[model samples]
Target: MIKPSSYCNEDDGEFKKEWKNDSNSSSVNSSTLSLHIAAYENSSNSDMASTADTEGLKGKHSLAKKWKNAKHPFFGSSSVIQNSFEFTRQQENDKVSQSEIMQFKASQKLLNPNSSVNHQPGEKNMCLFTLLRCSDLVMQKQRNPEKKKHLLVKKLAKEGYNDIYSNEPTKFIYLGNAGFVCGVSPTYLQELFGKLDGFHKLHSFRHKSYAFVEFKTVEDGKRAYELYDFPAIEAAPKAILPKGLSVISEFITPEYEEELLGFLNENNEDMKNRSVLHFGHKFDYDSNSAFQKGLDIPPILDELIKSMQPHFGTHFPDQITVNRYRPGQSIPMHVDTHSAFEEPIISLSLQSSINLDYTHCANPTVNTEISLPRRSLLIMKGESRYCWRHGIRPRASDVGEDGELVPREERYSITFRKIRTKPCECPYIEYCDWNRNGVTAIPSNNESARQVEKTYVQQVYEDIAEHFSQTRHSKWNAVANFLDSLSKGSVVLDAGCGNGKYLSTKTDKFFMGFDTCHNLLRVANTKGEVMNGSLFEIPIRDSVCDAVICIAVIHHFSTVERRKAAIAEITRVLTSGGKALITVWSIDQKTDGQMSAYAKMRSNKEPTEMKQENNAKLMIHDGTDFSHCDMLVPWQRSSDGAQFFRYYHLFYKDELDALVESFDELTVIDSAYEQGNFIVIFQKK
Candidate 1:
């Protein structure tokens, strides 16, 4: 440390007077007293320069009187270093004159010699120890010390660094894949690291989870690396991944994932639209020859496209293939044909979390697996997309980041790609089959297409539970009033009580609800008892419920036989005199005008109409045959600048009544149209 030359003569006298008056000064060491004197001398000149009467005092009372009673800038009452800087504020709020100020100035001089220094108000004159002091506060929080310490222990344990408080300097640890689990707090880490010799500062990575324990000298890092390299207890999980593969944990929020799922569900039918090359012009795997007009990017997916602008740069993706996966379902191992799509393909996952297997196309033995969390966005480009044939194994569940085998839930992924019009211009020319030499591959059959549709029905609703729960907060007055009419102590059965929004209102009755989607049931179970069961085959026995209400569930069946079976099941569950209510979306609703307006906006024939409030119309679709009375309607959920969709079937007014009439065990009590739904009350005969 460098020594200072001089202090203001008047300041020394005042400091001495205050120091002698203090009773605690007797306990202070000689070194601390010397430091106080040095600090007062160095900062005295700067403080005196800022006074309002510097010139007046110098002319009248001379130098000694000018410095007397000017200000106790260094200390609050010239007692100790802690009371001055840490406890109380000095007269000059702008400048914090402390013992550390002398050392900071000396360090500055040593680093940059022969430099002129000026200490003024509102200037960047903060000492180096300011950060250290700030960090110390975290370790010594005033309130609820036990609770804070427990939280700190839990956080450190999650990162596999539970001994952080004890084994800090010896172990320079950084967290990986800290999606939900808390890690060592920044302030705590800083405080611990600041105690190390030759410590500079801590540096966090682009991803918030990762950080570096930086030191001023290379020797410190080497020593730390050697000591903590193979500790008895590992600090962080070992990441053994294939080359060019990465997992970004929690890339998107749960609410945002729900919105994306809702948007996709609403616009799912557009994937079958004529403009899309993949849908209209089928790929013949055998010949490897196909028209390259490319798939048309749907206008509904513009929000996702815009969100990906920062990554793709000038090249906007021209194709989006949304795939919904059910439990035990996985994609085959195959490279995205080089000529079909450009480099840097991105896939945004929503709903369920799963593991992806990446195997080298050339070297089949070289493969690795990466666990993907829900709402993670994966970017596959160059070697990862081309050289590797990435796929997922067929499994109902996968290991999570926490190392537990978690059961797989329904999942949806939106894969975005820039369609490559031309053929074969990659490093793996031998594997390039875009310009095929007469090699033929069989096309997918109709059964495969039906399987995909079946999966969509099961997976879409399951994946959007969290997001769908958010919107289902408002209970329909019509349904709530109907539940209110029921007598107290009546056992009520809600067939598809999503999130149990109405169950809360019927507290007087013992209400039990069930749905096919377990994820949705998870949300509903919080409010009331909910079971995982289908409408056609309810887990409950016959004549058990006092009343059964199957709301918006009858139309889900595509066939008349299945729809009739669902009605019979509900009737079977109710007593002879018990009342049952059923509701379904109606085709009688006049949404044709809105549908035409949406088609026009989608076609860009009338771009100005895009701003129109036709969200309901945009989602409804009428089947080609009105006689079948089977049409698909979509529900849109938008959140955080993204959208998702879920599909439902609407029933014609007469068709719903006819199905209910066919149930021989039930008699129609009342029928009415309320809130775009055909609601009918039936009494068990």
Candidate 2:
């Protein structure tokens, strides 16, 4: 009889070697068990199947009868009898594989025959049972190689297999036949596949027309294979063009385009580079405005406008600006000044094709790129003309939808517009230059304030979080000193804690920060505990924080009531006598004899005047002194050249003190002007 202790040896090599040596003995005490072990040991040899058919047929019959009556060692006695009988029936029906049957029989023989039949199996017996099940799964996988391995791993996990084996790295081969073709660059492949989860690295063999992608886990590789191994159904391109904008391709025949280009060539003074000619009005490129009237439109262009009258309906363009761009010349991204031009603006492209990009004025995420072929007419009106900035990038070649580079040549465009006789009254009030300067009162109610904050503050921060984080690495000395003064083991909260710059100042204290922008919170999460929440309604319980800090956050509120409520919420979360530090942009940038850092950073060049009357919000010019108490500050992203505007309500002297003093439960402890901010420290009563 085989010794149970020998079967339970920790080293699997010794146990298997002992079993193999014992199988060759003719004097083995358990003859029936020896036959099963020998059969399993030689199962991989081709001749073993024939040997079992010839010399082992009677033995197999006798063994099946014994297996039906014997108890299974792995499963407990309550179910082993039923399980063993069912397994014997499966063998007689040929439902189980020959190798699987041998493996099961060999494992059963290793158990001590003299032990109690109802005793529980040991850990080694359980391991043997797991091996038998795993071998059965391997046989099933070979029969159907396309079976998803993740499902097999999940089944194994349910059967008590080690979880580490399920997470082993898996290699996936992406055949080039599906959508992607051979000889496609690896850079392009990485761009397409790198977005999937668990992607480690990819190796391309262009000559063999396939690539190998190694995933961090088997499940990840199986998911990627299911998604990319087969030809995918093409999806319709999303509609990104702004409303009221349309492009007419091949708007004019080749002959008509030549006629229009002939007049422009004749009128073009400087042919080697960029040249411009304005008619009906002299366009001041610097001011983006039409000034004194200039020459009349050429007779050929006037005739073309007359022919195009039906498309314009009642708004006939009275001004024309003809621009000729040499091989690499292009226009900067800009919205035609709202005060300068009327609706239904049109541009006719001639000579060569070029690309035009449009970005929404308020939301940079809503954008599109267009290619204007030669002889195409680009029409803009309503939101497209008033709310989207259009420009052409300076490049010798343009990237097409397929990512191929299309070389460029000389191009000419004739822009036609009518000088504005009145302020724009379109529906896009937030983006309209006229409306921004008009007598639109400050948001009076909570709903109106929420709308203003949502579009100008919250949305802008979410879009510029990455670029904004790069510029905010330096913490203010006053704020850092306040954090350093905190007691050890104190619970601190940073409201509107953008990028969590101050969270790591003193690791001794428990720091938790929250922000309204998820993008900023994602960055903050790596530094400390951070959550997505609003300043107006902090999620923490009342009187939970020993100290609170609100930095340059209350100024984003559009109205006095909202700002005061934000302050109240901060105090509500503070413990009794707990101190809170708050800061806001001050209207008075210059204090005492020194200019604040904001004013010092202003460019030497003159800024365009955007002052408005009647308490209207002004558009703050880039790198300039503030001219209004409330304004829209512009932030342009460096990556895509998209601009987003954030709203700010600057605080005047003693303004923050009065706002904090209105709450009966708070007391102002200290106030000062640091940098360009109005800093105030207060305590909850």
Name the top TM-score candidate.
Answer: 2
Cand. 2 TM to true fold: 0.44
Candidate 2 residues lying further than 4 Å off, grouped into runs, are 1-301, 304-315, 318-340, 343-416, 419-431, 434-441, 591-605, 617-622
Judge candidate 1 at residue 176 and give its lDDT.
25
Best by lDDT: 2
lDDT of 2 at 24: 46
Q: Give the TM-score of candidate 1.
A: 0.33
Q: After superposition, how far is residue 452 of candidate 2 from its true place, in Å?
A: 0.9
Per-residue CA lDDT of candidate 1, range 322-358, in tens? Answer: 7777687777666776777776778877788888877
- TM-scores of all models? 0.33, 0.44
Count clashes in each candidate, considering only residues at least 3 apart in sequence or on different chains. Answer: 15, 0
Candidate 2: tens digits of C-alpha lDDT, residues 181-209: 32244554454445465666554432222
